[model samples]
Target: MKKITVKITSILIALAMVFTFVPASVVATEDVTEQTEQQEQVEEVVTEEEVVTEEEVVTEEEVVTEEEVVTEEEVVTEEEATTEEESTETVVFDDINHWAKDQILKMHAKGVVLGDDQGKFNPNNNITRAEFTAMVNRVFGFVAQAELSFTDVQGDEWYAEDLAKAVAAGYIDGYPDGTMLPNNYITRQEAAKIVVEVFGFADMSAVEGNEFADFAYVGEWAQNYVAIAKEKSYVKGYEDGTFKPQSNIRRGETVQMLVNSTGEIITEAGTYTEDFATNVVVRSADVVLEDLTIEGDLYLAPGVGEGEVVLENVVVEGTTFVAANANLAGEFATVVVNAPVAVNIVEQASITNFVVNNKAAGANITAIAAMVFEPKAAVKVNGQDVVAGSKVTVSGGGETVVEPPSSQDPIVEEEHSVYEFSFELPTEIVAEEDVEVAVTFAATEVKDLGYENVRFAFAVATDVEDAEVTFTAVDSEGTEYTFTNEGAWGPAAGFAIPADYTAATDWTLNFSKAGTYTITFQLVTVDGEVLVEGTQEVVVLEEATIVEEHSVYEFSFELPTEIVAEEDVEVAVTFAATEVKDLGYENVRFVFAVATDVEDAEVTFTAVDSEGTEYTFTNEGAWGPAAGFAIPADYTAATDWTLNFSKAGTYTITFQLVTVDGEVLVEGTQEVVVLEEATEEVIEEETTEETTEEV
Candidate 1:
């Protein structure tokens, strides 16, 4: 993003340079020089006063006196002539101290307004409609001329091109009778209407009450525009509290109104790093803007075709218009459609309010992620009201999800067969830890009622890269099923729930990093038709303490790194006797726990001592005989264990030393791989060899 500090003065300078006009001060200086030369000639005439006395004797006393009076009259007349000459040579307005003097001069320097051929700027004179149109056209750079058909505006008229441009720009229109009174003086209200239209300020025309004492006298057609102009400070009421809207507007007043409504027009492709005190028109694309505050409306003009405009850390205090087929990225206050163009709200971009006006009936707004609309935000299309949570396709992202306002819960339409659906997740959990989420589902009327494929589908989306989710459910026959997805939607097959089931609860989520996550679930049919769906959010907090630092004791263990599925493999886990005695407890127990990612997978550990005694335990709990395999605390030798896996997947085995009070003194985890069951051919070969040996 390019950074440029553009002051309001710099904008005026740029505008002046664009039009190649002489400054009003320079014009004033030339007028002063001419006046000074005239004064020197007057002085030279005064030096000739002695010659009058030298010629006194040529005539009688009365004649000499009459000549003297004539000479004095001539001197006064010459002075008057010099004053007139000075006025004619003055290129600036006579009202140098006028209230709108600065604006008028600036407008003149920008070539938006001009003085007469006699070098007189009649500041207080009424401005004609043609003149106002020309000023507005120049201010907005509206050069595209429309074909004129007005009876009074011929092609050869001085204001013909300007009227054509204003008409083309859709700001000014002729009378319905096909006549444009070009030379007629435009009223204040009429100029206000044109100013509003030229600046695309119609959205702000909604006013609360009459702000002017004479507002009732304002033309009905121009009332709203007058209100908007007053609200925007482009026009003001008199000190007497009346907006003389019916009175013809003066040329200086017109300049002030136009200047108030003017803004910077960005015509080139580059970054703009200046805070704009007024509106900004983006006429070019491939522009990056940053760290700037725009106090007025922003226009993504139609000239920016198919190009991308990026706004970073930019704040717009007024409505924004997307009139181009452009990609926008960054934050915006309010965005409205002006053209029927496809607007891509790329990643990281957000719009506070989005409006699709009648002129942009088919405007397309697409976003990379779900666009959440504020509750108070107005989103309308072709004058029809559209609520928040309207589905929008998520390109280059996950499933399309529309988050409703937080004040209301998402209402599942009654048309969906599975009416009761909810996702219960912990609002906050420690990161790098496993957490359980409860899922409930019930169908009012199940489609394909007896189908076994009818199940629940779930998806987990998070900023954390290593986040994972597991779905577990139990059937009517006590058969447990589990499914796990790495980062996205789980199990293309989904988790099958019994047809008679209601509110099945066991689901698990694990986060490897601290972040926010969204969990979405849907009751899907056999053919993947979503019956009902809901989404919930969870916040994962960073772990307060590391596991190792919190452990009371430290120990090491060993187990089989790999094993075959459905097979019993002999494995031994050894813990140092000295480390156990260090606990100084008369009685303690050995704890083993196992968990895996395989669907419906289970692990069992059977302890075998030197005396050939065997004890069995499942990977269900920790610390006691009822929870896990317990070993005698006095045992000073290593214990051997047999492990068996029901399915092929990655498994985690945890070894812990704990007291009878169930306090773990030490704990460690080791990863184990459960490979697929041995091939049937190997078993057949072994059987054939045994049969042959017996034969």
Candidate 2:
């Protein structure tokens, strides 16, 4: 009951948010555009009344009690579940735009909608002319075609009238041929025209002013409409200042854009005042990590900029620290780092200036302790590679500089480093005739792991044709055994699994006990970082194993009659299931609803001889069920044929009332069957054995 209530509430919230968020000048219908390479919006449409009325009673008769029961049982054994059908299928919504498919439909019976000619919407498919027309028709009741001026449009065409009406209703346009090009892929311009027209906006003269980069491509006729849309907050440009007017808007972006455009942006602007002589004050919640420049004045806003709003170029003069991160919210707020971060932040907690001394020393630092000078292992520690990124223990004098603990938050690669690998050689002065092993370290770094097995990450690349770069882990203490690419040494593609290494494995790859080990990644290189390139270091923190998702499926059935071949027999069947472990599919139905119509139904002749010997008239070959055979035909006609379920399982069955629309939905089932009892010996064995097994 709680679950159902929550589901209903979530749907209501979504619907309300959508309405409040839509812009002032625009009204949007529930849109489900079919795009080949993009996902559609996840819409939850709840009635307005339902959103307001919390006290409304949900009748018990309408509740799916079986789901409640199944939900309880699903708490166990879900891992063993598997999909039985070879073909992939999903449920279809009653409307053309559906997230899931359903059988034994009711929405269609209410005259609210209709399925495609095949009686299936092909929910996962792209939309076609006929289908889109049908969908549009369902949304807007069929109307007499308003006379169209296009010569290509004809009354004889099935969709001709619909295309004409859609245009007449200001939904689309047609060429001079009178033919509305319904089959062409909808373009951005065409889409824009429809949107403006639908929103009841009249075409206007082009904006006779300087156009920003965002509106550079807007058509002359559509310029005024675009301007109005912008002023009314109906659209936004990308951060790069390009509106991408001609590009097809993605489904996710479309939703977000719609939300931003329509919602009221109320902001309570205030100033944050702080002393910048000692510290740096960031008024905006999000601060960039990149270097920043503020006018030679330092002052915090008297108070903070209050409210959920996209903060843009807020002015901050005086001393300032530019955020290093390329992307940060609230990029502009006048402030400064009057002093270096290290000195100021430590002593004065309230100081707004960042002095240069706050950096961690000794074992705390990582980039320095682990260094790969070559461009291959281009590891950047804050700013400096060798000195800055190195690990350190104490600061004032010389302290123990070793690896720290494992990295809790691992360093994620923004992009995959591309490289060419081969055993080819350049002839400056080679050791091996074919190749020379010149160690070039890719970018490297160590992670913060609170003293766990401290590990570092590195990358390697080469131009050798069947080339696999190997890392030879050597002791940082001595120069005797060195890095090599000979044996198993490279990590997995994701750099998750380490390759098996033999020489110096103890010092380099082995983590026999949780202690700090300095790992240096080296690769044989030829010259200035061209053949190979990548980040070099990362710290491994912990090992975790987890299982993802689980669910349950159960189904059962039995034949209707034993010997009623002379008359039509209504096959009795039911759905009953419970979930265990929930590792797989829930809400699974038995595929046993195949009705035996006159064409597919059959009656055959067969009898047993009265004597000890038996003779058969019509052989049972090719007799029962389609797709593989079942329930031998030689048995008495209609002798309650044993039905095969989509899957095998022991499910508790309970019938439910079903409805076409609102009438008494299907009444609960009366007849039920439990799996037959096992043999006494079998039961005894199961009880005695270490592991009980069932078939």
**Best model number under TM-score:** 1
Candidate 1 whole-model C-alpha lDDT, 0 to 1:
0.57
TM-score of each: 0.39, 0.21
Question: What lDDT score is found at residue 417 in candidate 2?
Answer: 30
Per-residue accuracy of model 1 over 565-647 as CA lDDT, tens digit each: 88898776666544333233335666778877778888888875566666787775443344444333333445666788898
Top candidate on lDDT is 1
Model 1, which residues run further than 4 Å from truth? 1-97, 108-111, 114-121, 203-205, 263-270, 282-287, 301-310, 324-327, 340-344, 361-366, 372-695
10 residues in a row with least lDDT, candidate 2? 16-25
- Per-candidate Cα RMSD to the true structure, in Å, reads 27.8, 39.5
Off by over 4 Å in 2: 1-144, 148-158, 170-173, 203-214, 231-241, 248-695
Tens digit of per-residue lDDT, candidate 2, span 1-695: 22222234333221111001111111112133343433224323445544433455444233321111212211211111212121112243432222121111212221223444444433333333333433333322324344443334445655555555554344544442223445443323333444343333343343455333756676665566555444433454443444445554322233222322211111123322221211222323232222333332222221122211121232334333321111112223322211111111111112222221211221111121212211112222234332332342322222233333226643332342332222222222211222232333322222221111112233433333343333434444544333343232332111121122112223232222221223234332111012222232222223322545332323334543232223322333432323445243222211112222234332222323224343222212222223322211121122122332222223222322222222322223223222234457655765878464432
